[model samples]
Target: MSGPGSAVLAQLLAQSAGQGADLLALRAIAEEAGDLAAGRALARLGLEDAQAAKDMAELRELLAAWRAAKKSLWKAVLGWIVKMALVLMLAGLAVKLRLWELLE
Candidate 1:
């Protein structure tokens, strides 16, 4: 059955059923023959590859979200520092002007 056509392979596959056939070997042969079984196997492989790619994409998205959150946290902390500095400056100005003496 060297270089058998797809139709012949299909016929053989149909005939081989329940005859204790080695389906793995037949699948390999079908791959060489470019038969329907090979097409099915390749479709399964394609689905697996697509799933892997989707997982990678999700991981990348998670990483991007983490980076954005880190950047936002730094910005909030920096803003807090500026606000604290401004408050301290205002208090120092009041003390310099002797405004505290009026509180007595």
Candidate 2:
């Protein structure tokens, strides 16, 4: 026996990749694989139709969150760089105005 759990999972994945396997089929495969693997199941549990949709929803949510976080981080970095540039430009302007004397 080559581990029925893995064999079933592989078959499920293969079936899922095929053109004919729709969402319902994929959920069926998941449920069957979960049943066969029992305690050793590698994926999500639950056989409800909504369960698969929930998984997809959660994945989308995570992706959206990651994108938002990435955008925020870039914006923060850009803001810091702009702030630094403004400060430097103001300092240069002040020096040129002779408001602050530079001692060499």
Candidate 2 per-residue lDDT, tens place, 1-104, comes to 15987687667667776867676677676778667776444344553445777787998999999999999999999999999999999989988888766543
Predicted candidate 1 versus true structure: per-residue lDDT over 1-104, tens digit per residue: 55567568767776775587887787687677666656678678664454766877898999999999999999999999999999999999999999999999
Q: Which ten residues in a row have the lowest lDDT in candidate 1?
A: 42-51
What would the TM-scores of all predictions be? 0.51, 0.48
Question: Which window of ten consecutive residues has the lowest lDDT sum in model 2?
Answer: 39-48
What's the distance in Å from true for residue 39, model 2? 23
Task: Mark the regions of model 1 whose C-alpha exceeds 4 Å error after superposition.
Answer: 1-48
- For model 2, the superposed segments whose C-alpha errors exceed 4 Å read 1-50, 101-104
For this target, which candidate reaches the highest TM-score against the unseen true structure? 1
**Model 1, C-alpha of 40: deviation from truth (Å):** 22
